[model samples]
Target: MAKNMYSLMLMDEVVSQIDRIAAQSSTNRSNLINEILADYVSFVTPQKHIQNIFESISAIIDDVAALTVQDMAASSVICIKSALSYKYRPTIRYSVELFSDNKSLGELRVTFRTQSAELLMEITHFLSLWMQLEQHYISKFDSKDSISYAIEQGRFKRTLMYPKNSSLHNSDEVSKAIADYIQMFDEILKGYLNGEYNTDADVEYRYLNYLKSGLTVI
Candidate 1:
């Protein structure tokens, strides 16, 4: 386990309520508070970690253009790898079982969802050519669980929103989908650049440099 470093701030009212419940549960308020804090971080980071990873990547990219995946700082590396609880199985794993019927014990293994094998394989193949993936980015579609994806990318963006969300807070499938959506945007942006698609103001990713390569000032 890596070192967990961050400030702790619990609301006064919440602390008071925790004290009352702590007395009944035979647990100290601090212990309860810490448990809740851990739960929140565990439940939150995996999905949003990509943004934080990307932000760190983007910042260093200008100064450390030669930086490879291995060059990322330990903290960043931990944060990024912690997000890959599925694909990094064995070393970092998620368990799964498949059944011929709901009650029948058919198969079991340390892995993510089996229904996602094809998509997961697709992402794995794409990632093999890219940098060693630290965190997998995800995006969702209207169908939510049914149409989801994950993508391996060079850069990540956004940070503050990394620890807060409702629908995606505890769903791995949604994370996979979100990754796919981002990859789709990347593909769209690439196609538009290669003249495969018409250029439009509303580019999915809207990278001005990659979009037209003509936006700059003296």
Candidate 2:
């Protein structure tokens, strides 16, 4: 039996960066990275097969050209593009609401086609960086686009990052919003599998562990 599928090491620079990001974002760094990992799932789709599947779902959205497979060469493009945009950290969860399907509140597990281990690490790295930035801005820092300083007075009003807006807001509101996005993502996944699948619909899948750990955005 293999033990510990992944290894962990502490680098000083990473820790320092994490601290700075944590201070700026008002997140504790660990949570920030977790959020990023959750969002990366949206980008996990392969380039080649996306169109074949999307072509199959053409009837649901009533797009006549969707059946043609000509436009599908637009690799990595999804019909619900915005749902996977992930502009902000929390927005990943918010994306679940865009779907029309209704799945029972159980669990679903789906797999992406695999090509060994090359791309997964790259995805993880990019997502980790973005997550740190999102956490800092969304939770801790207030941004300013324009500069305001007194040059003539021989004094500089340093740009300040305000620390406000603690995470004391209502919990239920957040939960419902997250649930909506999850539902929408589920709907999209259900649609994709139905289109692409020839195997049994009830097949047990290992991807369910992801939902249990945390959801990711593409």
Candidate 3:
């Protein structure tokens, strides 16, 4: 959304009340006021879209065992936290930032963290292969360079475009995409780290099995 500077006059009591609410919410006064005005105007802001996406994701993955999804913040830049399947159960953070002009599309970031050097190296290898697989798979949809991944120290970050297709016109479609991505990623990573597979072919086979089994969350 485009922002503009505007001068307004308000009563002292109203300003003080807004300040109190802002302090309690741990948000700056300007942001608090913006949200209040956006609500009053019935604008479907990016923050609202993000919240809907998070709710949908929660519903889709709620049944997965040993998994937890949390909304780190209910704002335009929504950070979602999920527990990955690992020795120490390292957590993955999905920071979703939506563009106000297009509520159906956004940037989805998958971030992983672990302390062990060995595990980190293995994860990096897995991420590289995963990137190749996704690139090849999405190419069938005529997508070009829509997914990217990077690794630094103990963190692995994979960024992908949400609603890869603009036709994914609703919150449900976007939510399903998010859930499906997380499930596929978790399954393949755990399978690889658990010594269940050694090659890309094996991973493909497992993923196909997952599709046939109609399991989108694990």
lDDT of 3 by residue, 80-135 (tens): 56665678977777666655544225566667766777877887787777767666
TM-score of 3: 0.76
Per-prediction TM-score, please? 0.23, 0.20, 0.76
* CA lDDT of each prediction against the hidden true structure: 0.34, 0.31, 0.67
Residue ranges of candidate 2 with Cα displaced over 4 Å: 1-115, 141-172, 180-218
Judged by lDDT against the true structure, how good is candidate 1? Answer: 0.34
After superposition, candidate 3 runs with Cα above 4 Å error: 71-74, 77-91, 101-104, 142-145, 162-165, 208-218
1-218 in candidate 2: lDDT tens per residue?
A: 11234445869898788878866755566644544554575432121122233333333334422112123322322222212212231111111111111111111121222232443342233334323433433333332222122211111111212123323122233233233333443443333334432222221222233334444211
Indicate the residue-level lDDT of 170 in model 2. 26
lDDT string, candidate 1, 1-218, tens digits? 23355676869898799999877755676655665666787743331343343444334433422222233232222111112223333121211111222122111111222244553564344333221211221222111122112332322222111222333322343233333323333454335434554434333234333324431100
Candidate 1 ranges beyond 4 A from true positions: 1-166, 199-218
Better of 2 and 3 by lDDT: 3
Clashes of 2: 13
